[model samples]
Target: MTSAPKPISAIDLFCGAGGLSLGLKQAGIEVAAGFDFDESCRFPYEANIGARFVHADIAEVTAEHLEEIWDGAETRLLAGCAPCQPFSSHRRGADTSEESNWSLLEHFGRLVNETKPEFVTMENVVRLMRMPVFEQFVQGLEELGYTVDYRTVNGPLFGLAQTRRRLILVASRQGEINVPKGLGNGPATTVRDIISGLPVLENGQSDPTDPLHRARSLSPLNLKRMRASKPGGTWRDWPEALLAACHRKPSGQSFQSFYSRMEWDRPAPTITTQAYNFGTGRFGHPDQDRSLTLREAAMLQGFPVDYQFVPTGSKPTLSKVGKLIGNAVPPAFGRAVGQTFIRALAQSIEQGEPT
Candidate 1:
């Protein structure tokens, strides 16, 4: 009898709050541990996922360190979404080669080159495909004998509640492997479908039962603007008297989504680090008059409702918790990647090939 495909375990780099790890575990992969520089991710990463969270700067992490933590499985994987701010479209038209965050992707490649894990996967903003670093990262894997495939994955296509697209790249040393294909079928999930049942909360109020459901307080003027705003509408919907100074400037014309409310029937705008603040993006609630709460944002990013992003007894603040939730890989998308890896591995094993 053929043995089951050797078990696969993962070490998630930059694992904020274990979003990706949770998805991998859901796909039947063991996430041995998670590594990140953010201390705040420790409790949430461990509390919810039951994996060790190593707090260390990725640039300083060596191949030996990864190997040390990458124990307990015959076949292993290295997965990460390195700091992506440097490659974001907002920074388009500028030379990003020298951005400090650029080195984080290189470090991800460096560790992969050095340790030579059997399988590897990475997720990042789609714009990264235009950068030379991405080409180099892919070339490095191919040169090391890894078969690589990558694609831009649409979030809502995969049941994530946001209108976001990320580049997912998977490399395997075992056999030919392809990134999963196709935009998902049929009527996609909507913001209301995912979060409307949440208990209503006024500005600055939190669900007493679920601390993460708290909303940030809105200013009186902003509150008025929110009340007048329509779903899927822009700042122009506001009365001229309520328009911000920037809204009058020609440059601000492009900031249409700023301080806007989400459409109940459509996927949400991309959740960002400052999503708790209404003026940051189209983050306002569909029916309420506040930006998406921590719980709402996390759920939009595909975190389970019970996922804990902070320690019990301590309330979560907007800045710290927002970064964790916004930066996470939507767990549903992560599960898709994990499922692809498993499918490829299964094909190899069924063919009497070693993985």
Candidate 2:
């Protein structure tokens, strides 16, 4: 009988709250460590995934550091989901050259060349494909003798409850590699599927049993606006009196998704760092008269309901926690990537080739 394939080890760069690491661990890859410049990520990353968190800028991480992290493993996988803000839709009209994040992808390419890992993966906003930097990064990987494949994917199609699209790239020194096709054919996961079972709370109320279920307070005008809102409906549905001055402007007509409620049967809009704020997007609950709570936002991101965001005794601030949850790679998508990597490794082993 053929022996089972040996396990592959990985290190996650830009790991945020261990979302990618958690999915990778569940998919049978041993996550040795995670590196990020944000110190806040250390708590949740180490606590939940048990991977040592290295708090340092990616530019400061040397090949020697990765060698130590790899520690002579037969297969080394480096995963980098660099921050996508520089390439996000939100930055469409802005000048991104001055942004420090614009250089992170190139920096990631440098690390890959320095370490020469056998396997690699990266995730980013779909908009990155439109940027020249992304092209350069891909070319750099190809020039280094790595076979690379990348594609844009819809998150809901991968069993996530949110309708987010991302670009995923997988590279291998062993042979050609590609991201696995999504498993979301029958019926897409809906807003009701994930958050309907959670306890109900009033606007600005916190669940006594769960700290993350706390909601932020809304102004009276916004409260009335939410009450007037319907699932899958836009702010346009509101009465003339409740409409904001901006909405009266022609430009405001273009921003119809803001302050809208999510539909129960449909997948939610892409959760953002400000999702807890009702005005950010269509983040309002279908039944509840308030915006989505921190926990709800995390769930939509494909994080387990029990995933710890902050340690006990530490206050959960919306800005901090929201950024962590929103910036995370949906664990479901990460799981798919991890499974693809495992399959590649298995294929190489079966063919009597090194990975």
Best by TM-score: 2
lDDT of candidate 1 over 170-215, digit per residue (tens): 9999899887764559788899899998999998888999999998
Candidate 2: regions farther than 4 A off: 85-101, 353-355
Error of model 2, residue 121, in angstroms: 0.5
Q: How accurate is candidate 2 locally (lDDT)?
A: 0.88
Q: Which window of 10 residues has the lowest lDDT sum in candidate 2?
A: 85-94
Report the C-alpha displacement of residue 16, candidate 2, in angstroms.
1.2
